[model samples]
Target: MNSHHQIIKTSPASLFLFCLLILPLSATCNVEKTVVARCIDQERDALLKFKHHIQSDECGLMDLWGNPGTPDCCTWKGVSCSNPSGHVIGLNLSAAPYQKTCLSISVFSPSLSELKFLKYLDLSSNYFYDMEIPSSIGSLVNLIHLNLSDSGFSGDIPHQLGNLSRLTSLDLSRNDELSAQSLNWLSQLTLLRDINLSGTDLSEATDWTQSIGSLSMLEVLQMDHCQLSTPLTSSSILYANLRIVSLSINYYINSSIFQWLFNNSNYSTVKQSLEYLDLSYNSFQGPIPNEIGNLKFLAYLNLSRNSFSRTVPDAMGNMEFLKYLDLSYNSLSSTIPDEIGNLQSLMYMDLSYNSLSGSIPSTLRFSGALETMHSLSYLDLSHNRLEGFAPGDVEDSHSTSHINSSNQLEGPIPSSVGGSSPLLHLDISYNLLQGSIPSAIGDLHSIVHIDLSYNHLQGPIPSSLGGASSISYLDFSNNYLEGAIPISIANLKYLGYLDLSNNYLRGDIPCKLEITKTPYFAKFTYNNLSGSIPIKLSYLGYNAFEGNPNFHMDKFQGRCDDDKHDGNIYLGLYVSIGLGFYTGFWVFCGTLTLKNSWRHAYFRFLDRIIDKIYVVVAVYLARFRRKSQV
Candidate 1:
């Protein structure tokens, strides 16, 4: 009986061991099940649904999915972020639909609505056949930005967008359906900071000022290129908060109307915050207001391509922060104010194509910021009546040149112009300044382009000129600058254009000279230059020297014999261009064999070819000359 009891107790021990082993396994299984319940089947479900939709679509979503349409729409062109879960916030599906056989709009991926946290939705740069915006966009309230611009949507914008209040920046530029009326729902949005409705036909905008003006926090309102019938002048206070404003290429062509409309808006306090203002290509006239200087914060002001008249205001000096000042293409007259130089931050300045006449200011120190600009290029003061050396001391290191007329303004250039600033471009043509060319002029190291034509600068040409190694373009034509062509000009490695026509400059051209790489054009016409046409000048035609009255050419086989060559030298230039190309090609080929490789094979080959060619040419030339003598 005791033995039987022991056996039953041992059997229970085996059963207990089995139950303990299964307990941990059960716990693990349970935990795994819980994780599965929590994890969303985002990828599998979304892709599966996308594939099914592409496989069968009644809304013709297959067109956007493209021909031989993929079963999985997410795999189509321009489609990104196929995950249905909120993990994907950016989706750029554009220009996917191209169905010539089935030209119809379709919602290819209805599962896109499954993405709850999409922040950026760009369907632009596409020919998507979407005539109406997908209504599911309202479901993605987590969106901070939504762009369906240029997606072929032609219907009115839905009011469902009023739900997107988190937007700080919005762009609907280049949309045909986006009009002022469709965007009128944006009046109540408080978080909006930027909005672009450019290229939209908003001419039918009703109560636009009352609607758009209420966006108090809006800093950039780009309704540029819009056809708005309503004048924004009524909401000057609304637009005053803007730091950058561009109304360029609009229909406000009436100067009086534009100014009056601009004045209707508060130009006083609002103008102060404006940093960059572009009113180019508009109809703006009258003297710029004295209040314009109130924009102390304004740094860049472009009033070019306009009809603005009267003298520039002295108050402009108050804008110490002003940097880029472009007043080109205007009728501004009178001498530039010495105070104009007070803009300490001034860097790029373009006063080209204006009617300003005067001596340059002396104290025009520029902004320190100019030193840091990587592309701070172009300072054009051409086509104006600015005479003498632009003010300031020629001794100043920054000055390109100094024109010291001594108030006895002569028709000849003064010698003191050598003291002016060393600008990249110096155009003092079409003036009455006259004097002998100063040797100090050669000291201008920063001079790259000089147009001293149509003046009375005379005396022997300085050979030291163009030794700076930076002169690229030099035109001394229509002047009394005489004497032989400066041999020192050969030092100009970067010279691309040389115009010396109508000058008293003489002498034969030098033998060893370099006139830039290709794409070079040089002129010495109407000069007293008497010498054989340089065989090296096979590339350049004659128009560059039309005015040289006493220029003569040596008898050469290559020189054009016809007097017609003198009347219009550029006549057969196009036909002769093939010669330039032919020579350039051969030279490039010869250099290619030697560059970097330093190949001994190439060297030997070239030496043999060159020697053979030289010998042959010499023999041919001697024979030809003997025949001529005979």
Candidate 2:
């Protein structure tokens, strides 16, 4: 047996040295843990005081703010603290669902200044009730993001906000009562990357453009509804880094602003850097200048709701990267340039409510013949002067979804519309379109809404339409359509709205089992339909079945016995009655089955009732026989 036992033990001096080396490290770890886990007591008390000043907490934010069990305010909702510093850095109590009662404050809370480390503070969408923006907000000099938009703060905007030298984003929009006499404060925010002052009154701020121009790092500026109708001088500087600019709804009539934005010679910076531009709902008139195409990087362009008249510039085709283009609600005339198909990345293009005339470009069609602009998903040229037939031979339009061109176009709808595209909505109402609706339209598995009313179309409603299980709204009213209403319409599980009034349709109203159980709207008035109207559809009221003399409308007379029937009252009554009968029958049977005493009592009661009925019958029989003998 070769046993080797080498037991070496540490000395007292060595153990003491090891303890000396590990104790300080353990203490440091505890110190760091305390710092990271707990928020400062001063900041927490300040937050509580702020909450106390709020007259309304309808959003229930207070419930999560000061919980006794969780003393750490950092763990509370909408509070973010810094690491190792134990200081509150962010407080976002914005976008709460409460309406006017949200976090109401009559005065700005000075306690907010105690959060010296706050870098982000958002009190947007709250109700402040026309209080002046306090200068104390500037004390939070470390703030990089501040949003007080849509909060009822009136009076002059405090210039002290400019003291936040580190601020990169500032939003003071939707406070219609707020005004700025001078934009000198804005000039001091040199590091600002985004600023939104929409709905604020800045009519007196003549130096608005000059102040904003000074910010070399400014990238996004939105000053819509700011009463900025005054024209900018040609010498006004443009931002080289500006990517997005929205100045809509100010009724700006200055063509000079356009000169400053698109002039290739003087303002080459904005011409090259601007990517998203929105100048809609303004009074800027005259033809859209060809210089707009200078911005090759522009992706979204919205020049709608303006007084701009004349043909759309062909230069628009030069912006190959344009994804969203809306020129609706203008006085634009002339045929749509075929060059629009050059935008390969275009997704949505709307030119409705204009005076544009001529046939729709083949490039915009769902037909696969010219596979131009394959990525287009939505195209709406409705309420225009366009004429001629709609595009046909649609077999490869895999992305076109919405087509609402209610113009003078007259022709048969393409039959292969349902081939590959997942069309979601189709509305060609109030047009001169003739011929029957294509049956292939029913094959669109993703179709949601379809409207083809007020046309000269004539034919029987397609039976295959019931296959569109996702369709929620269908309208074929005021048309020449005839023949029986398809019974297959009952298969639509999601059909919520149906209107086939004023048509020559003649048939029995189909009973939709599921529709009767749920809420739905249907109108079949002025039709030749002759049959007993579905009792369930009576919930839609008498007007829905009026004007059809052949229809047995007596079934709906006195149905609800009151005018309250207009609001689904009768349908609710039927459902309640059905549920009550079902529930009551099961309850009675269950009670008898579950309790032996109840079961015996029920049978005994039945026996006595039967004996009484038998005696009555015997007496009646003897009386009848005696009368016969007499």
Please name the candidate that would achieve the greatest TM-score relative to the true structure: 2
Measured with C-alpha atoms, the lDDT of residue 351 in candidate 2 is: 93
Point out the worst 10-residue segment of candidate 2 by lDDT. Answer: 1-10
lDDT of 1 by residue, 1-630 (tens): 795454345555564664466777755322112121111346336534654544233334334443454534455443444243325555654433542222223454668677665676765544335456656766777677676656556555666766777766666676666554555677756677777766666666665566666777778766666665555553334455677766666665344433533464555656667787777777777777666777789888888888878888899989888888888888888877777756766666777777777665544322221223222344566677765553223343443322221122235443444544455666666665567666666766777877776767788777768655688888777788788987777777888888788777777665345577556878888777765556556456565444545544432224333434654667577658988999999897867676757566677899999999999999999999999999
lDDT for 103 in candidate 2 is 79
Tens digit per residue, CA lDDT, model 2, 1-630: 122111113455654565567786755433112234579999999998998888877677667778888889999878999987889999998854555545788767799999999999999998888998889999999999999999999999998998999999999999989999988898888999999999999888888978887787889989988998566666667768899988888886455678778652436777677889988888878899988877788999998898888998888889988999999999999998887878888888999999999877777766632387777888888888888875676666646455555688888877777774477888888888888988887888788888889989899999988888788888999999999988778777787888999999997787542353235888899999887667567667778888888888876323322344555777898899999999999999999999999999999999999999999999999999999999
Models 1 onward score TM values of 0.64, 0.78
Give the Cα-based TM-score of candidate 2 against the true structure.
0.78
Per-candidate alpha-carbon RMSD to the true structure: 17.6, 13.0
Range of the 10 consecutive residues with the lowest summed lDDT in candidate 1: 30-39
Query: What TM-score, to 2 decimals, does candidate 1 have?
Result: 0.64
Structure candidate 2, residue pairs in collision: none
